[model samples]
Target: MFTQFVQQFGVTTCGTMVWGWHGRTLSSGVHHPQYGDCWLRLLAAPKAKAGGKLWDGPRLAAERFDGRVHKAQMYASVPHVLDDFAYLAELSRAITEPVCSEEPVLREEPALPDRWWASLQTDLDTVAHGTSDRVAVRQEWINRVVPQFLNVEPPQIRHWAVAHGDLHPANLTAGTPYLLDWEGFGLAPVGYDQALLTAYSCLVPGFVKKVRDIFPVLQNEDGRAALLVVIADLLQSASRGDHPELAPALHELARTAI
Candidate 1:
């Protein structure tokens, strides 16, 4: 079905995922006929019934803060009811730059541009009060996840803002630094995104420090509380056998945060 769809646009499939119904890559001819160098990505759309926000976050970022997000070309619907949607978007390639590592890293830093940080802050501000189609962050979810793993009580949240809920090194590109994967973007605690990045970089002291230096919110009370929320979420994911290699590092971070 996807192959036939690509054929309609006269674009060839350059790559496909080995497993999962998540992704496909198409030749750049779909976007440009002459200097067709850009790649197109076919990504799995989030399910509405599953509390997916459908492209609300990315669309807002693209329209309001252009450079912060990759642009989308179109979307298609599948016949099936459950797994029924996909979106085609322009895939960004770093210009002589390093892509973010998918695996957890303890060292090896990538240079992130100052403009990218500015874009992130601007993006967060633009979407801070925007309506979300995904599940809103709740104190109950935090309560359920936190106390089960940590002895400390969940921290009170005094500030709220829209966040790239899955913010981490993997979801971010270095150098130019465009944030990817908006399926989980929604209203979260103000510092939640930075907290997740910090947790992911916890294995690298220098990188963690870099994150702290970039986002000074992590040094405050609300930021510390938000980091606990991220740690709680990570612990929940770890319990399900995801990122088992980072289990030790996650545990250490959780202890310190708590």
Candidate 2:
């Protein structure tokens, strides 16, 4: 059944004959003696297309097969981020809790409501010292704006469903747009996805307005400030890599942070 579908949708991928190992969302190139190996991540369509072709959609980390560490982290983290946001959005609507408010939508989670903002602070602290100083600065900015603009007092965030800790286009894929990578996913901060998306909008135009319309709570400065925090976080993330394609945007985000 899978092979038939691949025949139809999978793009013709060319590389030296190498071993293939499949995982949840990625396939690794078997280490080979010659013609350095590469990875081919298959993105099968939800439904098969013409001629029962299986679309071997895109290959992630094609050039370098050595850094299994970074590749695995990204693969897991990206989907986890998407799932968290999607889950939180659904829970917020089901309970009719203002998606934009920093309050718990699921009152049943009592312990959660009490420590929402505190949890955020802890995460911020982790990033400040662990990720980069810029991340810490951005988190500080977010803390200031929350009380002043969003009117969120001592407990600015409400207990809610888990959130996709980090969300951005690079971490996501349209074929499997909603994969689950749980490492950074957690609960805290309202409109977190919108903030991340808005920050990404600076790189891809029209993204900001589109995300804002879908997430109405992001219309003001408070929401935008929250978005800046995520953007700063992403900048720190991008800086850790040597991918030239990511450097320019990271540099731009750094400038925007100031």
Candidate 3:
């Protein structure tokens, strides 16, 4: 079916494995067996069309097994998607060079629907300030930790660029390091991404440190606190179902948060 859809497009492969999770793909090169090294990807349509303009790489068009039209973006290597703090630091410095006519990598928040912010609030309130079950801890965190560190109001989250919303190693790729799966993308403080990467890094070593270093805006303590909130929310929502694999990770996250 894919062959028929991409018949004249010189498609190289179909369903070739690439790094991804949820509904988005990171990188999947379709190598034309007869066309030598010709290859490309079939990226799904981004949740936010405006976000696509911020994408930094080659682009293509793709269709799903169900005949849904999708944009296919190409990348030379997905490994570049991995968060390498050292490399990012250099890139940051290069981009900050004054008088450079090149396209400035705009690090700004994307417009989001109002309801999305409300949904995140449930977790933010539970984690940042705790619920009725542990008001003292929430108070302590707010008075002693959250304010001194995070430095942002719970309702207003415009201090940082748009976060991937759902960030994990699975969303990354080695061929073209594109941050796929924008369904959860939204505006938040810098610590949100750091916290997420830190929590997930417990299962995969070194991811936390690199994410922190690359995005130096996050304080270690604040990042952990923010992460605790996110984990708690994720545990309560996505992992709350009967998925055995996530049950334990969810419990652990909930316990740690409270």
- Using TM-score, give the best candidate's number: 1
Which ranges of candidate 1 are over 4 A from the true structure?
16-51, 54-97, 104-107, 113-133
* Candidate-wise lDDT, in order: 0.61, 0.34, 0.35
Off by over 4 Å in 2: 1-161, 171-177, 238-258
Q: By lDDT, highest first, what's the ranking?
A: 1, 3, 2
| Model 2 Cα lDDT, one tens digit per residue, 1-258 | 223222333323333332222322333232222322323333322232311111211112111211221122222101112221210000000011122212111111112232333443343333222221111123445465434422333223332223344444444322212222222444435556556645654544444445566565556544544554555455554556423344355346434333
List the candidates' TM-scores in order: 0.73, 0.35, 0.40
The 10-residue segment with the lowest total lDDT in model 3: 86-95
Q: How do the residues 142-198 of candidate 3 rate in per-residue lDDT, one tens digit apiece?
A: 334333323333222323433444544443322223333333444444466546644
Model 2, TM vs. native: 0.35
Say which prediction, candidate 2 or candidate 3, comes out ahead on lDDT: 3
- Model 1 residue 255 distance off true place after TM-score fit, in angstroms: 4.0
